[model samples]
Target: MTGEKVSFGFEDVSEEEKVSRVKGVFRSVASKYDLMNDLMSGGIHRIWKSNTIARLNPQPGELLLDCAGGTGDIARAFVAKAEEVRQRRGGEPAMAIVTDINDDMLLAGLEQRGDDGLIWACADATKLPFPDKCVDVVTISFGIRNVVDIPAALREFRRVLKPGGRFACLEFSHMATKEMQAAYDAYSFNVIPQLGKIVTGDKDSYQYLVESIRRFPKQEKFADMIKEAGFSKVSFTNYTGGVAALHTGWAI
Candidate 1:
């Protein structure tokens, strides 16, 4: 332990501890992750993900590296969209590699919906296993907040992308209006943990998750961070009045 404090939810913990706790949280919730996501967002998360995939505009023969890709949701969707393009035109099959630090999360993805054109690996977001400038697209959905060194991870995302390649992130973000923020806080603090307990038998994990979202940087600030990570043409679009946001940039 370098005695470096990192946010594990609202609580401060050592970087190593944060990593271990995050891994444990995912491992505990791995089996019920998708169900919890649907329940938490009232199935709107699907629409958000669909919007992300559409914005990414996955092309045939492109490679997508989905860091912190739990249960392969984004990976599967990316491959499917790319395949649609390939089938319509003529191109090589696109590949999506789903990587998460938690082994159980990877296992859950493989067990739940293993599909062709998708590869699963255990990887840390801050230190990806692949060579630099190797992938066409890099995406992390609803997962970057949990990373202890977000800037480092962002740099890694840029590092793995080929020049002109795109990077997109979908994350829970700050709401636009004070009224909306108030209402969202009420529901998030009051309701989400209970739902977690009912569904996954882990209220604490959900509590941490909620806090993590609040701790995450707001839209404009995060976009700046992406730019600072050596990406250009960075921008962000808020979804559902900023309940979530999609941030995009180019490696160049």
Candidate 2:
């Protein structure tokens, strides 16, 4: 370790070792991640995630990869929708594989969701383990912010997706209006970490949560990055006055 160090979010430490910071965070918060999310977003994350599932339009015999699938919420959501589709259209559900770098979180997800053998893997988003053009759809809800390199992850998502595959990312985004921005910041700073303390007994992890959201790329710039990753028809839909945005693209 060097005497001098660099900043990783609000803390300053380690010039060459700041990047795995997110892994540390998720490790610390893994057990209570879902509970804290419910407390922090007031269950609105469910709505945002539900909307993302809708945009996906998953069909039978398709494969879905839910990256950073912490508690398997997106996988469950996809299965739920697929079941609904099956009721009317009458077919099997799409395969939803939940992958996360943190084993603790992935294990909890596996435990909670109980398996349909819906492939769970330990992997990095920037360097996925799947073969090229193997998945029909890829979704990473609130996962990209923790990635050290956003652009590389975008390219990887595109790579794993089959031709014309769909990619939907649900992430915390810049608020649309000044008033909403101020309110969002206030709530983020004051309320969220406090909930983390009360719920997960971890405040610093939640503080980093707030900071990462602030540091994430803006809406249009991120869409541009997706396009640069060789995706086509990139677009984003801002939800709740841009507090969260769903960016969509198709691998061509």
Candidate 3:
């Protein structure tokens, strides 16, 4: 894939360029990313993430590898939920490894909540640094579409999971109906970038984010991609009139 071109928010660019630009975009918005999410979705992203964690059913003593875990939202939640279960069931402690390709995002996460005892690392999704079958759960939230090689990343997610381990992803997806699609498109293409400019002073990054969501595959198609990447019993749950979705599979 050295010379291949990939979609960088509706524009065709070389893989290296896409990686560089995506890192830059995240770096630009790292400090304000969570705030932008709340503004863009009216706090609905929090619900979506909560639902995702519930469905994941994190267990005590399980290790979760949260890829592209930008601000460690999912990681913190997973560890907390698992700890809750451990307290009730009398089990070992649970842990999470929050990894991102961009250091600025990781630094932002550390600055916000570094005392949670969660491990932090810099890692590429397509080529993870962990050993095979190392983690019980793998998750990526709102970050897969920015990957230069999505299929490779999926395989890596599967690769790092132990047998019978779970994989979950939360991402922006197509709206359920044409009417809703029209309304959502008008709002997304018109308002989101301006909100980004107001909040983060970076309109282009948010524009690319919206475009990347549009470029992502539909729910069923992504489930099939997960199946093709050696996962089984793949499924997805649409959230908020399909404005976002949670996809899940098991490494078997």
Candidate 4:
């Protein structure tokens, strides 16, 4: 491992090592990812994602770049919402491009979604493939924490988005109440990994996932980080009493 280190869940490892380990984690869980998500979050992840899409307010003719779109949840919503707008107003439909660092995850998304008119690409979040000002919206849902360098990904989001374009992120967050936090901790540390083992036959991956959520910056801090990355109008809304959060910013 190199001297430059980063967190792979609760463990500290070299930057390269973290990337490889994270890739392995995703690859291991790719097939059962969506199912495990439903189990672990009790289907609240869907609600959180729906809240994110609503806040994004997808419109006709807009191009949405969904980075680390794993299993294509966000991209699917974006494309569908844009299509709804198009059918209602009689204009060209909006587009969504789903990019993921893990090929297995991308393949899973492809297989699950089939050809829904959403473009799929295997790409890294920190170094997005799109040209400058190429998209009207950029979103990374429940995936940014897995990035090796979140700031780099945020910068890439800014680069790809047109001025006035929006960036939205939905991810696990610290709970609002101490009582709720305690309960969440118990569930996270005890139940989620077991659920992962039962459902995906991979407990360690789920353990790492829970730990990664803890390692991620809290809601307000993440909003500031987005602003530091050159996003304006940065704001966040907590969901499910802060069990998850939706952070939004404008490229401006």
| Candidate 3 segments exceeding 4 Å error | none
Model 2: residues >4 Å from true position, as ranges? Answer: 1-7, 10-16
Candidate 2 per-residue C-alpha lDDT over 184-209 given as tens digits, one digit per residue, 9 for 90 to 100: 99999999988888878888889998
Candidate 3 C-alpha lDDT tens digits along 50-92: 9999999988999999999999999999999998999999798
Instruction: Give the winner by lDDT: 1 or 4.
Output: 1
Please give the lDDT score at residue 140 for candidate 1: 98
Q: Is candidate 2 or candidate 3 better by TM-score?
A: 3
C-alpha lDDT of all candidate models, in order = 0.94, 0.85, 0.94, 0.90
* Candidate with better lDDT, 2 vs 3: 3
Candidates arranged by TM-score, highest first:
3, 1, 4, 2
* Model 4 TM-score relative to the real fold: 0.97
- Best to worst by lDDT, what's the order? 3, 1, 4, 2
How many clashes in candidate 3? Answer: 0
Positional deviation of 203 in candidate 4, in angstroms? 0.6
RMSD in Å for candidate 1, one decimal? Answer: 0.9
Give the true-structure RMSD of model 3: 0.7
Error of 2 at 158 (Å): 0.6
Query: Which candidate leads the pack in lDDT?
Result: 3
Residue 146 deviation, candidate 3, in Å?
0.6
